[model samples]
Target: MKKRRGLSFSQRRAMSGFLFCLPFILGFLLMFLVPMLQSIQYAFSSMQLGLDGIMLRFVGLKNFRTALFADPEYVRTIAESVRDMVLQVPVILVFSLFVSLLLNQKFRGRALARAIFFLPVIVVSGIILEILSTDYLSASIMSGQETIGAFRGVGSYEILVAMGMPQKLIDIMIPVVYDIFNLVWSSGVQILMFLAGLQTVPDSMYECARLEGATAWEAFWKITFPLISPMLLMNVVYSVADYFTTSMNPVIRMINQQTSNMKFEYAAGLSWMYLAVVLVLLGAVYWFMNKRIVYVGE
Candidate 1:
């Protein structure tokens, strides 16, 4: 009999990755797929909980129509959520990258600093974050009359107005700046991801750049940025998903409200519509960023 050839290194690595992902793949199919299909079906039907169990009647596009046209606040809330996402994702990504870079440097208590930064991911649940926002954090940030007066008196708002910026734009920027802490807190996982990516960069590349008399800024653009471009894309996608699904998201809160009110079919329609919008935006981002990502092998 002819001897069988052993698997190559690349093939073995591919198999290992597939094995690692098997559990998640199985869980997604078993747990998420059925409910997702049911929800889609419900979106096209009227659902009622009955003594017999549940009743679903074909309602065609009525639920979609109601969510889109009948509900006054649904579309507006979605629009607001999208606008917040646009403002928040970039800030989160930048903050995460900055923190990751800082943490990657050798320093006293580096591990402790990383743990401190990542503590929010472990301890700050949705309810806890909400409580903190309502009780002490947001109150302190927004209630400082002196700080508010100083900001206003500094001609910051006036400068923007004189620069012909719209009042709506100014309104969005103020709240976003005030909520920067919350945005930074949301970057814990992203910071960790960037740290991992940063560790993957070969030190020799930086040493070579240094030998060439490159400044830290030049080395960063020439070596670090391109090397971490993949991580940037990953963080962008994660941030988008996290922002949309977080409890503070107005769209998600609206959906939860509908579910609480037993408007199951309407909520399903709304969720499906929101999911489509997210997918479209995600696709656009992926398309734009995918072209710019530089692979080390490439």
Candidate 2:
């Protein structure tokens, strides 16, 4: 009898990946799929929570119409969120890449520095973050009476205004700068991803570039940037999703408010609309980035 053929390396790797993801696939189908389908049904109908259970009546997109046309704040909040995301994603990616580069270098207290930077990823749950923002921790770390007064007295925006920057420009930048700390805190995972990507770059590539008389800047653009482009794309997608789902996001808060007010049908419609927007934005970003990604193995 002929011997059975073994799986090829690529096939084996693909099988392993699928095996790892199988549990998640099963869990999503078993636990989430039914509820999600029900939510979609809810979005297209009117739901009343009676003593018996939820009573759903076919409404034929009335909830969607009400959410889009009648609700004053939904569209404006969505617009604001989209604008914030466009501004924030780039800043977060750049900041994460910069910090990851710094962390990748060998130095005294490097482990400590990395731990400090990554602490947010471990501890930044909704309740903990709210407590931190409300309690003395925020006052001590993020702002203080003296610090607030100092910034108001001699703020960067004031300096820019003095230097002949337009009020419109200052207005745009001030909020971004004011929330810089929050941005940095949200970058922990991206920073970790970049650091991991940097570590995967072979030292020999940099050594060869150095031998070829490449400057540090040239070497980075030619070698490091291309190698890490995949991670950059990942960070962008992750940051966008993270920003949308975070507790402080007004869109998420609005959804919660709707649910609390027993407006389930409206909330379901709003959530579906929000999910569509996120999918569209992410699809565009992925298409743009996928074209530029350099697969070193390929």
Candidate 3:
């Protein structure tokens, strides 16, 4: 064979990277990018099942107008969903990190505890979740019928009732505290991520801090928190998205309503709008947290 041309290091790396990303790029374009652009076009069009099946014709921005203004229920549903995600995500992140720290400690039955924590993720989806939330199961096991039946006989409810709370106060307190329970319930992934990050931290750093007369709280603030912050960010984004897409998410209930009502175009518009809102929220989180992320390797 003739002498082969040699590639430079950057050129070789670029080629390898591009080759690795090629499948992802192709999938994104075919599965997401194309479908998204088509959805945007369809959002401005009236869709109906004609003789030839579904037909689309342009109606400009009527869909957006209807969704954003005229469709009262859709707007209200979106607002409620946004509120829920915002409230739940931070709670999940903090709880998950704490759990991760506990799990990472040298203790008995750690593996079993981790498995127990991850059970919800497996159990709380599809048919199993549906069966669990049914009237028979709820009345028998879950105590009260609230969001996901998480707050059946908890102390929060007992305390509210003992305080002689009003009807509305009891109603709100049930779901709010149940949501905190739910947050802790689904924190396994974040815990795993935080555990991994915690593992990567050098023991020498903690040793140095201890030698410098740093207390446990001081070590956490100065060493643990900063070093593992990237994982915290990851967990935050994941928790936010997870909470919004959870089986008990009310926004999903709205989407199911739109589908059942045969408002496909409206549903599509709502989905795209919700996606934009999620992206913006994550972007805000990234922007706010980027400055605080300490590069431990540096």
Candidate 4:
């Protein structure tokens, strides 16, 4: 009898990945599919409450048109959401990677350091984030009700002037500077992801590089970075998603307002548009990063 062929190593790996993702695929189909389709239908229709149930009248983009042309705040909030995502994702990724690198190094209290960095992931939750995002809290801080918030006063502005930055640029950077705490707070998960990736990099590769007279920078650039590129891509996608959907996002707040006011179709339209923007951004990120990402064994 002829010997039967077995799957290739690559084929086995592919099958394993598929099996790992099978639960998520099944969950999405079973739990999310119907609600997602109904929400999409809501984006293009008017809702009516009848004795039977909620009836949807297909309106052919009227809801979308109203959201775009009629609501002034919608456009501004959307623009702000995108702008915040653009600004914060890079900062978050860089900070996460930097902290992860430090955490990956052998040092006293390494475990404690890792735990400290990841504490934000445990401590921050939806309710806490909502409170943090409150306008009243921001106003209180900015108006000097809090000592830390009083940093908004004069020092950074003076430093920027002394350094000769443009006033417009200073205005943008000042808010971002004050938001540093939030940025750092948001990086816990990405840091954990990066740490995982960093740990997977073999010590032998660094030893070999050292024996070859490679500087620490050279070793990092030549070995550590290339090996971690896949995780870098993953963290970037996560950061983008988190920034665009966070409780602090004005766009999401606006959508929630619409929903609360019984404007279900309008809210659906807003959410769908927001989702479209996020999907496009994630697609662009994947396209740009995929070519740069180095997979193991590749």
Candidate 5:
């Protein structure tokens, strides 16, 4: 092989990889960066639909002031959205891990099972979720017309509900009662990431643990959990974002309505503010979880 001047084989390979990604890099800057800057500009302005219905004028920082201090529903809506994020993140993480463990099991039909778990990541979109939203699986329970709900009655809680479980126990489960639904609908990516992480764990590590008289549960707690912690962190962030931006999400609907009503500047400000809050929360999660993660290669 002829040695290239200045650039080694690996360096040349890196350059080729950068060249391959050039189109995506350019598109991201053009499509996302320019629009994002424009949005930030608009967020500070006081643009509104005029009486002629096709004009706009600037009234700087008024939109932000209205959203922060004057608007009736803006604060409440944002608070509710953030509350949902906090609740949903942990619920999604635990349930996704549970489902992933099942999918990772060595079973005859495991591939099919994994596909079923991943259906949501593939098929979930605005249209499909809109169709499902009309069904309102939680409506009965929410309205107190039924003792329990549809999917909750059937899936993970089936055994307890059928066995005449205590009402208190059921009540306690209410906070995360529909978590299985969230899990089933969100497990696609997390399961795949977990499977990837599981592959990275060498079987020899388990063998060594076994030789040291470590039980299966001990091996999982000491070896498997730490090894996969980074993937766990990634899935947590993805699930939180996915929940907030989902088509079926109420906050997104509210934002859509604001846009349709031509409240462009206000909507833009709200979106930017909301995005900042989410970024801060995600940054906090990363900071707190980063140290706990064990880098197996190191």
Candidate 6:
């Protein structure tokens, strides 16, 4: 009987995907969209709390002007945040990738090693992490001479001093060196993502490369790197977002300070600007990396 035709496989698959995403779409619209719109409105308006609630008055570009010209520290803090992001993201990526490769190798206590690497992600999260920073738990526990952050950097700084390197070079290296522990802590998620990607590599490909007399390095470049390129892009995006949003980020701290001092409109404007900057960076990264990512079938 000439009744009805069902949807094609592709159409059905697309429908399924849409259904899977529907909840998130609805949530974004229903829950998050209003606040986001309000934030944009707040950015351009002067807001004051009254007996009722937030009272917003149209202020046009005043908040933006305040942030850009009136406040010197705002731009400086943002610049520092961006500078730290540029310095940190690559180091974190390389460190996580290298450690993932090591942990993927056949060895005793490999699981333990992976767990050790990942422990920070579980432990150093949320307000707990904030409380455990230098001003809090660290200050309470560490002696004057044995401060954790200083202790970690002191050895490296001394070694470099002994080496008679240029002061400018030493100044550069010292920050990166001092942040070694922080980098490690921040790397836990990236390391885990890399391990997931590494596990997806088929053993047969490596075996074939070995049979073809390819060295480990050649195998890595030819096989592993191409395959893991996708995950590398993911890690880059993640690291960028994490760096910009972390508790230690000066930009965020500045915004929080504004909010705390009841500078709601100004805070909103600063936040919107920061969000735009981050979004632009993320868009550029995704575009560049998406072009380079290798799919197995391709």
Cα TM-score per model: 0.81, 0.81, 0.76, 0.77, 0.78, 0.78
Candidate number with greatest TM-score:
2
Model 6, 1-298: lDDT tens per residue? 8979999999999999999999999999999999989889999999888999989999899999988899999889888888979897999999999999999999999999999999889877677666666454243332122333453444655676678988789777645544666778889999999999999999999999999999999999999999999999999999999989876678888899988998878889999999989999999999988998998887
Q: Write the per-residue lDDT of candidate 3 for residues 82-140, one digit (tens) a residue.
A: 88777767777788888888888989999999888777778666888777777453433
lDDT comparing candidate 5 with the true structure: 0.76
lDDT of 1: 0.86
For model 4, the superposed segments whose C-alpha errors exceed 4 Å read 1-26, 50-53, 125-178
Cα-based RMSD of candidate 1: 7.2
Q: Model 1, 176-286: lDDT tens per residue?
A: 776665766788999999999999999999999989999999998989999999999999999998889876688988999999999888889999999999999899999
**In model 1, how large is the Cα lDDT of residue 59?**
89
lDDT score of residue 99 within candidate 5: 76
lDDT of each: 0.86, 0.86, 0.77, 0.83, 0.76, 0.85
List the candidate 2 regions with Cα displacement exceeding 4 Å: 1-8, 126-178
lDDT of 4 by residue, 256-280 (tens): 8888999888889999988998999
Better of 4 and 5 by TM-score: 5
Q: Which candidate should be chosen as best, given lDDT against the real structure?
A: 1
Candidate 4 residue pairs in backbone clash: none
Candidate 6 residue-wise lDDT at 238: 96
Per-residue lDDT tens digits of candidate 5, residues 57-80? 677778878878998887788788
Model 5, runs deviating above 4 Å: 1-26, 48-55, 126-179
Error of 5 at 85 (Å): 2.1
Of candidates 4 and 3, the better by TM-score:
4
Displacement of residue 79 (Cα, Å) in model 5 is 2.3
lDDT of 3: 0.77
**Candidate rank order under lDDT:** 1, 2, 6, 4, 3, 5
Q: Report lDDT (Cα) of residue 74, candidate 6.
A: 86
| Winner by lDDT between candidate 4 and candidate 1 | 1
